[model samples]
Target: MAQQATPVRTARLGRTLGQEPTAVSGAVLLLPGGQEVSGRRPSSLLANASVRALGRRLARAGRGEGLAAHVVHYRYRGWNGGDAHLARDATWAVEEVLRRYGDVPVCLAGLDMGGRAALRAGGHEAVNSVVAIAPWLPEDDVAASPEPVKQLAGRQVLIVHGTNDARTDPELSFRFAERAKKANREVCRFEVHADGHGLRQYRDEVTALAADFMMGTLFGRAFARPVRDALAAPPPLGLRMPLAAGFGASLSW
Candidate 1:
């Protein structure tokens, strides 16, 4: 008889960027992007570099508040359709955080495919917020298998997308934000003009916005006016809020 493959198991799948905090008020899990469909090959460093940088920035911004940041190392490198392997890994990371820290709030932050995972995993009880940067939402038959929105209730959700990204349609994320906002008033989205899938053109501004949102949601810091206005405004206006140049430099906190 042929033996089945053994499942991989570990104490943790997260790599802390800095020294692990002895005590944390809150935590952020940074998830990196991957392919649409592929085998269970391990995720690469190239894919994780950007999110790591974002994690470092967030750690610095929330250092005084005792925020612990970790970059989640996914077991597989693809979305793999309904399997949703990456999302499961994100959920596991949340559990790991709870095990180590004991019931502290967590923010799920991801880019590209990682963003989709963050959204999918936001329903976890310990998760207080989610920051999806350049999220990849599949353009399938919406009526048949639309991405879920009901899971986001009572959580602060922020979706950031680049208008010019060709890899993933920005419109799809807007549609998602619209649906999420209907179910949960705290859902908001920001458009990064003239940027691409990687969002490198306005990296500073995007990172700043994400940091602000994460800190505000996890540590109770006041959000910037734009973030507050975006969440409070009605429909189209709030869902399609524009992110301006030098917005990061203007942030007070």
Candidate 2:
């Protein structure tokens, strides 16, 4: 029988999960942008900088909103970079996070390669929402994409990409959103300020908007069509994306 993929100890166990349960407002599993992060399982986990930023920023959304966010930084074997190979692991990781939080509402956010994995993981029934930054959805970048995301159409999703990103055309993000929307899946689209996939120019703003959407969906406020449509609407040229301001939270990240 084939072995099931699992998240094991990092190359170095200096920083490890299941060591001491970290207190959190909600869990944000950080799937690395690509095999680079997966291979090294860097001792430099986002558990502190990035994930904490997201947790703290979302704190202002409301205290004890009964949410717990943790960063799922795990080491997976292999490097096929396809859903067929990684989907089961993704699903298990999502379940593990939910289990850690005692089954509270779960929200996912991924950047680059992380974005793709998170969508694949959360597209299932347990995950309540998703935020994919600079997402990569198409298998054959040069060809049309399959509707795998269609399974997630009924769930909340946020696809944020930079217009000038060359790794994958920014338009691919929209087309993915459109497919999900067409399936009647709920989604929100946002454009990061400036160009490039690093999101160096708009990381703060991007995470802030991401936090708002996450908190809203967690609290059941983001599911309304009016709100979803408002989010999905295209921002006029030069706008900062998803407006990052209307939500009743302070943008700290």
Candidate 3:
């Protein structure tokens, strides 16, 4: 059996809202998804088991490569439509990483609204890559407002979406990915067969896929061929399958 890495320390810098700026720190920063309410901070990563679990997994992967992790707790907490609150916070987080680390590469990973924010902030010069897990990118009207996604022309991006996503349409993510691919040379899309927006059914698989992609993009490590093949493999029986935790099943992709 393969041994897992130890969990890294998580630090909370401070509250971020509007144009307020926070100090720079940490290697890879994580943001959790939530809605915009009144005068309260967004939910913490600990509140969301799935996002937190994914973060821990990524932390383990980065630990093996000497990378640290941080999670940004939003001030407003909501998408706020055209307000751009979430994107603003994400950009701030990236800027902090560069300010403290001095040109060090960073990867942004998010889910749902956080995913959209990550995509919006991926255009920054300091950001080397972005991973949007089941991002809430609606294609109806405001698709073009968040222009940073267009800036991913030559950036490395990974889009993970489930075909059965109920909250955010997977087709929208697919279309957005297609457009991103036309611009990005290293853009890759991993579609989860029948999982929903939360990806509860295949959380471990999603975490593994994300960790592998992040490690490759941020550290120049080669992704395992078996895992890559499994990701590339098509779904069996039309239902999404979960990849084993260590080295058990062969990756179809």
Candidate 4:
């Protein structure tokens, strides 16, 4: 054999949640929404090819902001996929991002089913940020998310959806807000007009919220007056503002 070459190993720059290394303050995990649809992977939420392209566009935006955001797409193994798998995958992705980055913040965002997954994953210790747009309720027509879910929270959340979105209905956003209130989680929600499920109304909000949410989660929230409201009573909107550590949002059209 000729002279053998050694593989080069790099240090992580971003935050770590699992065993992988992520780039510094640059990488974000974008999990596109995939519902139970007809596909080679039926259990996966089918956000469609168009949505996939949108993810790429978001990734570019992230890069433009000096953040290295990448989109991750995968199919769950069973019927009507649940957040359990989404959570697992997201956690793994976070570690990978951390291994690459070292100490920078890591964020996760999604639309529809993916939105729900982002919340589920953000609740874990691994995630430092999250964005949920028109998330699907765990139960049929449920207004607020369950108590356990509401409690397991962290990072900032930017919930944006159309007021007239026929797929999930506007009332659902209100319900989500209520649950966030109960959980005493900080959040921010926006109700865009005529945005519908495709989110055609406010494109700029997407980029702005993503950056703002990350900035707040990474550097804001600590020096502010502490949150003292009991978990039993309703949560104030400010506590659930669009910014803050482990924050959340409720955007409706």
Q: Report the number of the highest-lDDT candidate.
A: 1
Kindly report which residue stretches of model 4 are placed more than 4 angstroms away from their true locations once superposed.
1-23, 37-39, 42-66, 77-83, 140-148, 219-253
lDDT string for model 2 (16-105, tens) is 222233454454454445442244433344423554455455544434454444454445432354533334545666677556556666
Report the C-alpha lDDT of model 3 over 37-137, residue by residue, as the tens digit.
34345656444556666767777666645566666766676677676677788888887766666777888888887888888888888888788898888
Error of 4 at 177 (Å): 2.6
Model 4 residue 162 distance off true place after TM-score fit, in angstroms: 0.7
**lDDT at position 43, candidate 2:** 37
Clashes in candidate 4: how many?
Answer: 41
lDDT of all predictions, in order shown? Answer: 0.89, 0.58, 0.67, 0.53
Q: In model 4, state the lDDT of residue 9.
A: 26
Candidate 1 off by > 4 Å: 1-11, 140-143
Order of the predicted models by lDDT, top scorer first: 1, 3, 2, 4
Model 4: how far is 107 from its true place, Å? 1.1
Error of 3 at 223 (Å): 2.4
lDDT of 4 by residue, 118-200 (tens): 77777656566676777665543467435244523655555666777788655665566666644545555655666677765
Whole-structure CA lDDT of model 2: 0.58
| TM-score quality measure for candidate 1 | 0.94
In order of listing, the candidates' clash counts read: 0, 11, 11, 41
How far does residue 243 in candidate 1 sit from its true spot (Å)?
0.5
Query: What does the lDDT come to for candidate 4?
Result: 0.53
